[model samples]
Target: MPTEPYRIAYYTDEQGNKPFREWLQGLRDQIAAVRIRARLTRVKAGNFGPVRNVGEGVVELKIDHGPGYRVYYAIDAGTIILLLCGGHKRTQQRDVEIAQRFWKNHQEQRK
Candidate 1:
C-alpha cells in the first residue's frame, strides 16, 4: 500500500473531450468494465497491477480479460496518472501513437 494516494486524470484533447471516459463508456462487457475499474482503483492507490513501461514516458496497464486489453498512461507531476487511451493488441501501435500525441501536446501546453 502506498502512503500517498495518486490522482488519476483523463487526457483531454483540444476540443476538451475525455477519450478515456469515452472508452470506458463504450465498453460493452459489464464484467470487464467492473474488473477494469477495480484495477484502475488499485492503481490510484499505488498498487499498479501488471504495468509496464512501453516507451516515451508511456506505461501500459495490462488486463487479461478477453483477448487482452491495455490502458496507456503517463505519470505526470510525480503523482498524477494521466490516462491516455485504451485498446487491445491489434490496435496497440495506433493507440500508442494517440497516447504519445496527447502526451506531447499536453507537455507543450504546460510550457
Candidate 2:
C-alpha cells in the first residue's frame, strides 16, 4: 500500500486537446479498477513537471498506451498524479530528454 495519497497531472498538446480528454476519462476509470485491485488510491491533476516535486508523497509511473501515446504519473501518499500524456516513442530520446530538462527546471524553480 502507498504511504501517502497519489495525484494525477495532464500534459497539453494539440493531439491531446479533445481526444485525449475522452481517452483520459476512460483511462481514469481503468485506473480506478487498477487501484481497487491493487488496493491503492489514485488522483489526477495537470502540469506534469511541478507536481513531480511538489507532491513528495507520490511515486512516478509511465505507461505506453500505444504507438504515439505515453502516460506519465506519480503515485504517493495513497494518491496518483498523472504527469504527462502524449504521443511519442521510447526510441525518441529527445522527447525524454526534454521532459527531463523540464522537470529539472521545475526543481530549480522551487528553490
Candidate 3:
C-alpha cells in the first residue's frame, strides 16, 4: 500500500525572534535530509493550532540557543506537522487561550 503524506510547521517566540526564521529554515533542511534518507516527502504546516500535549511523537522539542522557546510538532502517517512554537511557558493557560483565539480567527479567515 502507498504511504500517507506528512508535513512540518514552526512557531517562534520573542527570545527566538531574531533567529527564529533562520532556525525554522535549518529545521526544514534537517527534516528534508531525514525525508531523503527515509524516502518520504514532508510539507510545512505553519501555525495550525495550540499544542496541548507533548509526548513521544507529540512533544515539544527545545531549540538550541532559543531560551523559553519550544518547538511543538507531531508525526502522522508520513508527515510531521508543526503545531505551535513559542515562549511564555510560565503562562501556560494564557498562552493556550491566546493561541486558541488566534487559531479560531485564522480558521474564520480561511472561510
Model 3 stretches astray by more than 4 angstroms = 1-4, 9-51, 54-68, 71-85
Per-residue lDDT tens digits for candidate 3, residues 1-111, read 755444544333435442223434455346443432232122242333333464334444333332344544444344555354333346545445544443443345446
So what's the TM-score on candidate 2? 0.38
Give the candidate number with the greatest TM-score.
1
Lowest summed-lDDT stretch of 10 residues in model 3?
Answer: 36-45
Model 3 lDDT, residue 21, Cα: 37
Q: How many residue pairs in model 3 have overlapping backbones?
A: 7
**TM values, all candidates:** 0.93, 0.38, 0.35
Q: Compared with the true structure, what per-residue lDDT tens digits does model 2 show for residues 4-110?
A: 43444443343444322344456544654353223222333322332223233223333423443343333323443434322235543544444454444444544
Q: Please report, in order, the local distance difference test score of every candidate based on alpha carbons.
A: 0.88, 0.38, 0.41
Off by over 4 Å in 2: 1-4, 10-65, 73-85
TM-score of candidate 3 relative to the true fold: 0.35
Residue 22 miss distance in model 2 (angstroms): 13
